[model samples]
Target chain A: MAYSATVGSVRHVFPDLKTVLARASPMRSGDVLAGVAAGSEQERVAAQLALADVALRDFLAADFVPYEDDEVTRLIIDTHDAEAFAPVSHMTVGELRDWLLSYDADGTAIAALSPGLTPEMAAAVSKLMRNRDLIQVARRIRVMTAFRSTLGGEGVMSTRLQPNHPTDDPRGVVASIIDGLMYGCGDAVIGINPATDSPVATIALLQMIDEIRETYEIPTQSCVLSHVTTSITCMERGAPMDLVFQSIAGTQAANAGFGITLDLLAQAQEAALSLKRGTVGDDVMYFETGQGAALSAGAHFGMDLQTVETRAYAVARAFKPLLVNTVVGFLGPEYLYDGKQIHRAGLEDHFCGKLLGLPMGCDVCYTNHAEADQDDMDTLLTSLGAAGCTFFITVPGSDDVMLGYQSASYHDALYVREVLGTRPAPEFEAWMQRMGMVGVDGRVRELPVAQHPVGALAELREHAA
Target chain B: MSGAADDAGAGAGASAPASAASTEPTEPGLRVVDPWLELRRFTPARIGLGRAGDALATKDQLALRLAHAQARDAVHAALDVDAIRGALDGHEVLHVRSAAPDRATYLQRPDLGRVLAEGEAARLRSAAVPVEAKGGPAVGATSGFDLAFVLADGLSPVAVQEHAASVLRATVSALPGWSVAPVVVATQARVALGDPIGEAIGARFVVVLVGERPGLSAADSLGLYLTYEPRTGRRDSERNCISNVRPPVGLSYEAAGHKLATLLREGLRLGLTGVGLKDEGPSLGA
Candidate 1:
């Protein structure tokens, strides 16, 4: 059926629900490249207006990708929590937005409603929200998870110490890890993006990090961001793995492109669980998502990029992951185009993921080809910090030599922690305190490397060797 | 670099308890040198740089900014057409522009970069005719050349300027008696630009040598894309890519050319390029 909206003497028509949702999205280059973007500003505003009145229940009836054709669509329909969604089931998309921002929709209320809200409903409501609205609504909701240390609480922000190397050099990776640890980073997890995507290389890196964790007794988890299949292979070889990591997407086809399936992810999760690696909680999966992944894979099924990205959160939601990060701006200029688009997309991903009951973080990063810089990242970092994002990917000097992109530096995380008045995970905070790295105020102390016992460069040499 | 050395010297001597000033702890404006700074020899990653109160030291920050600036410049830099044409003086070359009119448009609208501008396709189609076709039944035009090479100034034009011509020269030298078409140099182009160019030339295969997106450490990394039975609207799944083709830091010109030659030989023999063809030739260990 056609959807129509009349605005000031101009009447616009959209062919179907998918068209309405696609046209209603904020302008992004990927949407334009897909040939589904609104033709003009007038058409865009009209679509948004038409989308505002869409009943929340309408999303259940209109399958963007057919339920039979896609496992993601089937997952959304099969696992919905009707009891949690009872309160807002009658609300329109605009009404849902209003209700989310209302005084009554506190943390507890939103947490209860998370399981009931489908990805499409959350995406529709996000479309009607401004940047401030997105942040304001998201800040009130908290989705906490844990493995060795608890994450996501009031006045808490964590950092993923990403010590990536060009050739997966063990010394280089260990050196960067030590650099971040000195700054009181790596609370969320110490993950690596291995240069070589092979099982042998992955096992070597995993064993190295596992040795570090065991020797230091740091209260944190570790992951090697390889393919789920590779992680499974490592598991079969009895490699010391903490969190099973994979790059997931919104559509079934996109996940297939990454050589993954829902069943494979479930199997990997069970394998990780069988190891009994967690100390605090059982959430063991670590997922990395981005907006243009499905579109880039050519598996978006003619849906808008943002909406498709939201669907990926549903996949993460089902897994009960400890960390779900949006690697924004890494897709380059064709998907986002500029700093403004990346910044906005980062917030939207966080908000939608949090709304769907998932622990949401962001890799506030950019490639050289994208029209973005550290200043833009600082803006997104500050904004997401205020919005209570769970964690961020922090590297040495903010340069990922392996991936060839810039992300939040270990110092950048410190800057955010200082300015936002937030602290790290409680367990990791206590460990840092024990090492004299952070003071009583939970702020990292300014200790000379020669005086501080663990701050000495000799410690790294001993560890790496 | 000297300052770092001085700091290292100071750090070593201060811990010896020889100077009374050492008891007072680190002085203001002095960087607390990371003891593991010497470990930087193991990898190129920026590690063990001492910090100044939860921030990068002035020297390290400046070094990072310089690298970032070089990478950004590489991304926006224009392909040096005259120099490339000069480098390939002995070989026939054809120059054309994509539908994208300028650099900014080329970056934002990749769709425009995949198709030729008005009349550019006609020029390529007309150029497809072999000299013998003027006398015969146009069999060479229908059968087409064995392969066509395209040089596209993708994200990092610096890569194209530095390594594209050299790699192309090495690749052509490897294949003798092959009916290779006049090399097409496209500005404001993407990988798929080779598809339409190949289709117009009626070539059996198209090999695109385009500049890869610049990374902070390596600004001039070239990428090679090969497509068999090239045509418009081909999915990326139908093509094979050999990435990071820059010397010393990445795949060298000789190795990259050798690998491409192997793929072309294998692709022609296998009747495909994408998933069907695997680069099982001598591995490029670098």
Candidate 2:
């Protein structure tokens, strides 16, 4: 089917839904790299105008990627809730945007309508939104999920204390962990991205964090972000496992490039559930997705990068994941270009994920080669916080030496909480208050490590003893 | 230096302020340094940085910004071709450029960096020095040479400028009997740029020593990629990489050369250079 929009003397036509979606997407280098981006700024606005009139129901009628060819397409088609979609079936993408911002689409209303919305519909409506519209709509929806600690609640934000080390040294990892905990971070999870993907190294890192969590009685989970198969092997070896982590993408082929499948993820989830590790709930998966993964893997199949990224949320929501975040700028300038593009993509991912009833977080980060700085990250961090983002990835001093990029520091979390009046996950906050690391007013106590009430590093020495 | 040297003494013992009696009125921007700041010795990660108020201390913040600035500069830094030529004084070095016209285009369009400029391949094919084959009639050889060595500026020209010549010298000396082609010094090049250069030289294997993307911590880290059969459009899985060749902070020049030599010996023996060829030939000690 052809879609057209006229501006002044020019009439632009999009050949298909995928073309319209690609043309309407906010300017990003990845789409341009794929040669699917609109030819000019006027054409982009026209595509957005054309996209707004497409009915939400049309997204269901045809798949952007054929179902027989793509398993991700198959998952979207098979899992769609016709009953839930009946309420908004008649609305166009433009009308849906209006309804989303209206008084009628409250937290409960959006939650009820979530099952009815597919990733494509969510992606479609997001194209018609400005950054503020994305923020305002996402702010209203709360996708609360739990493993040991609950995430995605009103007036609460969580952080993934990513204490990554260059060589996965236990001492270096523990030092950062101690530093992050003192700053009142790690409410979501103390997840580590091991520099090496070997199973033995992964198990050692897992055991180290587990010992710390057990010794200190911190109310949170720990994960070593290795490949899913390595996590599975660690689980089989009786290692202390919490959330199973994997980097997922939108297309089946892209997932294959990551050496994963739906069946493999299910098996990993089943293994984690069998461990019976969580005290609060059984949402035990941690997923990381980004915009350029599919395109980088040569698996985008002609869709825009953002639309493909939204499809990843469909995969995440299927498993009731405890945490799912878009590593927004980690892919670097080739995809998101610079700070402004990274900031916009972060909000779009959060809005789309939250709108689809999945707990969404963002790695408000950038690589050195990208045209960005801490100031840009500050903008995104503040923006995502205002949008009630589920969590942020907090590294030590905002520099991840192992991953070789910059992310929000543990102190950045404190800044956002103070600015937005958001606290850590409830269980983690209570633990910190009990330990005197934070006060009841949700302020992290600024004290030297030795003088602080929680002498976490000293405790690590004693544990070694 | 106490905690920096002694791993076990890294906590508060070495990190506390010099004297308790020296306490004075705090200045407006004064930061309460983490008593265990000495632990910074253990990793390059920015840790134990004292916070002023749930934020990085001014010095620490500026240090991070400085590191970032340096890394960005490393990406845009031009390679000093004469310096590299001076380093490898005895070797026959041929200069070439990739299809990318400038640094900005090279950074954004990676595809442009993988191919040579319009006449570069043709020029190399006609002008390359002829060499005798070492192992008679190798499985993948299109030309007489067994291996082609390429040095590319890649994302971190700092890496190429700092370590490429020394590493290349060490690697060449280690491969005693192998028929090696004249080294190609490529500007604005990616790892895959070695393919057409190698194919033009008719070598069985291509080793591209290029500058890796500059990380905030290590700006001059070099990477070595080896591809067999020497052709365009080779999948990444069909290549083996030995990365982080910057010294002291990363792999030393000698160690990277040793690893490359091992991979070369095994790759030629196995007649492959990718997933099929693992780097288990021998340790540097062996």
Candidate 3:
């Protein structure tokens, strides 16, 4: 027979037919199905072979035409790869006959094709044919290929700076105020600024603080002090200072919006740093800067449409190396246009062009002062990609609430799954550690520790005492 | 029979007695009710009620019924022409009238209405809006908005007439970020026709609000169809639908404004569509 040579060669390599036959019966349907519903391509082929064997046995007893051993072997060779055929090496004589009959091939021709004609050899050929038949089966089992449910209920941290107000507690209100402005209330603590002396400012500041504290029960963090100016002021005193610049001059004192020209931003950043040396310690400072204005509205501070591009380039380039961190709060149309134009002009090349660019660790805050939605998020993410900005900040409760959460979670999960390839729990723990937050495990070491902290801390305290 | 005759005769006798007593020249049984009628009543040529009653006994009465039926048909033809003209603008109309087994079959078989009868496509092509001079960006017409509006016999034609203008106005105002030209309204259009119309107009996006196929409970439903980057190459996945167009059940006009704006923006950004867009997660608001 044509298949005799192939069968003899296969049997010679592994001579354990009886052991394979004994294990065939009493197999659970789920196990058999799962074996066929394998993950890799190789496993899927093996499972198909097993199912074919069962189908052949049933078909042989029925009125269907019997399949020959050579025809069965031919089908197996056509369908499955040679290297992954070992799993189907063991099939009983009955299973082999059944597999052949199920496939409706000539059983007499198969017997004539085999030179040695051992029950083991015949069974193996039958298994191979069964694998081939799997392709033709309509209701074949299915195994899910993608991992969709892995990143459930994960939270992303996003930060933003609110419009500064007076009478805000510096230490206790900064976090909530920024959180409220970023995610829109309840997620973080906020502070009051001491700059404004008006009763209304005081009342509004107090009300916001009470509301946030009552809602989340988290203490507020102070705003950075240098962000306060005549047009824009930090809400709390003794808060870390960051520069507040505006192109709209006296109009800045009146709800200036977030629109600042690049030149003004650079000037403000420099000036604020200088002022910080006199009032506060020279610790590394955080800068939360943003630009705003109506896009169609006329440009202010000698910055017309023509000069805005060049000015923005200069400002971003200058601030690339100075600040500890920066959040570019872009509120309105002016910022949108500026962002698009700046990107088109290759400002990203100057700041983030190189593999080892100077501003490697900067965080971005891309907020729309207006109501934001999913479209806004897509646009912002596109812009961030264009600017080569890797890290993103998201405030909860923006437009596309669920989508925003999903996007953020999916992005983080993909990074872990595809890039790092870490398992879910370990990856989750690592992410929490990086964020300076605690996970479900209650342990709060700054980093993963090898030794127990109780023993080490106890010995240290004993020495100190 | 005698009792019936006696009742009729008694009623007639009471009225005729006064006339008979004062008649100057009257036949023996004929009572003259008026002086002018008395001469005519006595004349042998004058055959009043007796001759009229005899005329009703012939089979010629059926002929009058046929004449009335013909007149009714003529009136209906004229009314149908007027309705077609009003519905189709000045464009010639082609209708495929169906005699279905029942109303259920008519409602269930939307595919039957989608395609025009034989030679209808050709007829429609001849009457279609002419292609104007193509000026502006060098890209193909497919690069921008194709057919902007399509009309249909949704749940309620009245609702379409009422809310279509406002919805279009809101969509246009919100989409200032993109260029929009004149909007067109196609009468008797179907949802599937959106693709063909979009192809004809050379629009990148087509927004169609049509009357929905009404249910027993709701006869005035409206539906929205928005196809992005609309072109011959586009697939069904590229099109997004905002269904339940009427107020209350789904999106309101104001809410639809934001939703449409977001959909258009995403479509523009992604360029490609389908499960890719749906899986892009929820809309801007949700």
Candidate 4:
């Protein structure tokens, strides 16, 4: 479809024409004046007005046409009149240039009128006008001014925690990981565990790495934090050498603990500095830590559930001084040796309450194995929340495991309410009050009134007096 | 001839006795045609390959024909660099030489294809190197080109040959104000090499379209990788990717382009890349 071009210049129409000179002389109130007056301001004004009339007519008739099926044309046509046309004639060269440059008025009117105009069409029109050089430089300046008004900023940090087994499709695994990193559980962390380490699995992992690098533009380093294993090696070695070989080549597992810790530290420092430097006004730091290899008795890294909790608590305490925002808790090794229930019952409590300071938190790992029954999940969530957990990330039985995580997250929310007596408490103040009270140091403490009887309150007051 | 006819007649008469004595008619019919009795009547040469002599073909022949057809198609559809240049309106065409001398060589030598050609330095010098700001000189700027387009011959050349235009159109449509540089087609390239292309163009954002490895079900899938403030010496952690750009199994061009644009805009806004930007999601529709 053909569209009309919007021209902002009068010189393009009349190159030789300078400011118009009026031939008619102005009439005095008591005396009749006739003929053109030499250098009369009134005459000049009349001439300029006539020139402006011509320019306005030409603009309306030539430049302002229906660009799209929109209200802009109707508004322009309805608004166009002798009065509107005359104002342009009175404008000085500078004023005219400014008016032309400020395409925002015209553009906005057009946009308002043309509700059906697609973004592409709008872009095309904008491009065409800019290319024609008829666009007023003043409009450019206007845009520049308004651009600052729209200025807003955000920051993101992504990390991928590798899984224990080789997955069927590594690309899917990586996508899920990145998705988790972006919008999974609160704080945005993703975990992966492949079932085996066959060539197919390695290829899948590599493919996932490639996809993250290529499709998502995630830095290979941060996108994949570490590939983990619960056991250093499986003792059952037999005909399938690939599995054994994979276990032996567990490089990611070996390096995961240190790698993830260092990554978290670096990310935290970066986020903190970004906030400090005013580069990022808002900050959310995420970390994905797993204990897949910790499931095996022989593969213990001298840190059981309690030790992990204490270490996490220390880390959280250290980061608290820096005012880091958002910490995600991910649990791994639930499927190690086919979900044999290796960990103790109070495991989540130490980590969630004592360490992370989360009254309710999500677990990032779930596999379809022997131990992930509904009851087991309910018990785990309840104990974790009571001990201060808030979110649990569980995968579905379908091909896309992340969808399952979303489903499990809803169920987990319910479980938290049912078991821990903590509902979706948006107001932290109310939550703290419900819990009991806050100490002067911002720690949870018993309310003085609750702790003391009504008569004891008076006694305390009397003691203070 | 008379003796043969008489023997045939006597055999036919002997078969009737078997047919009459049997309780089951079907069993008697099979007994009458017993191979042991008929074994002396046939020769080995007449029994094998006699009914369908000319119809059968060997497996090797079928494989050979299939390979020939593939080779023919590959040659016919090989991208014409000249045609691409004409389409780009006098933009200098960059021919990235893979270390692999030929297609076979290219397959084995992925590293060779990742580097720019010898003449690229001079071409880059002659062309306007991306500047951070308009007044800035065309060389050695901190922020580079407003936009950069990188094309790679990933696992499948056919993918590049098929989807380049559509992907480019979608991308250009999404980015309204940015100045898009000419597309660079690289052979035998990997994903990590996009950093250099960004550096070469001095681009704020680098978008690479490459062929994805063909699966058993899909042979011509395309993939895209976009990075914000892509420059030389940037680590792999500073980029994001959009994979599976072909239809059915992956994102369509329009969707991928829109997402890429959103990512770039978000990255630029945040001054961060990789995992930081992954969660930002698309801002266009939202």
Instruction: Please report the candidate that would top lDDT against the real structure.
Output: 2
List, residue by residue over A347-393, the lDDT tens digit for candidate 1.
Answer: 99999999998899999998777789988999999999999999999
Q: Write the per-residue lDDT of candidate 2 for residues A308-345, one digit (tens) a residue.
A: 99999999888889999999988877788889999999
Best by DockQ: 2
lDDT of each: 0.83, 0.84, 0.32, 0.35
List ranges where model 4 is wrong by over 4 Å: A1-247, A250-465, B1-78, B86-93, B98-100, B129-144, B279-286
In candidate 3, position A380 carries an lDDT of 40
Candidate 1, DockQ to 2 decimals?
A: 0.31
Q: Which candidate number maximizes TM-score?
A: 2
Provide the global lDDT of candidate 3 against the true structure: 0.32
Give each model's clash number.
0, 1, 59, 56
- What DockQ class does candidate 3 belong to? incorrect
lDDT for model 1? 0.83
The C-alpha stretches of model 1 lying farther than 4 A from their native spots are A440-442, A448-452, A455-465, B1-34, B128-144, B233-241, B262-286
Q: How does model 3 score by TM-score? A: 0.25
The Cα RMSD in angstroms, rounded to one decimal, for candidate 3 relative to the true structure is 35.2
Q: What is the alpha-carbon RMSD of candidate 1 to the true structure?
A: 7.0
Candidate 4 lDDT, A19-123, residue by residue in tens: 121121121110011112214444434433443333322333432223353232333344334443354445433344345445543534422323222111121
DockQ of each: 0.31, 0.32, 0.01, 0.01
Q: Point out the higher-scoring one by lDDT: 1 or 3.
A: 1
List the pairs of residues colliding in candidate 1: none
TM agreement with the true structure for every prediction: 0.90, 0.92, 0.25, 0.32
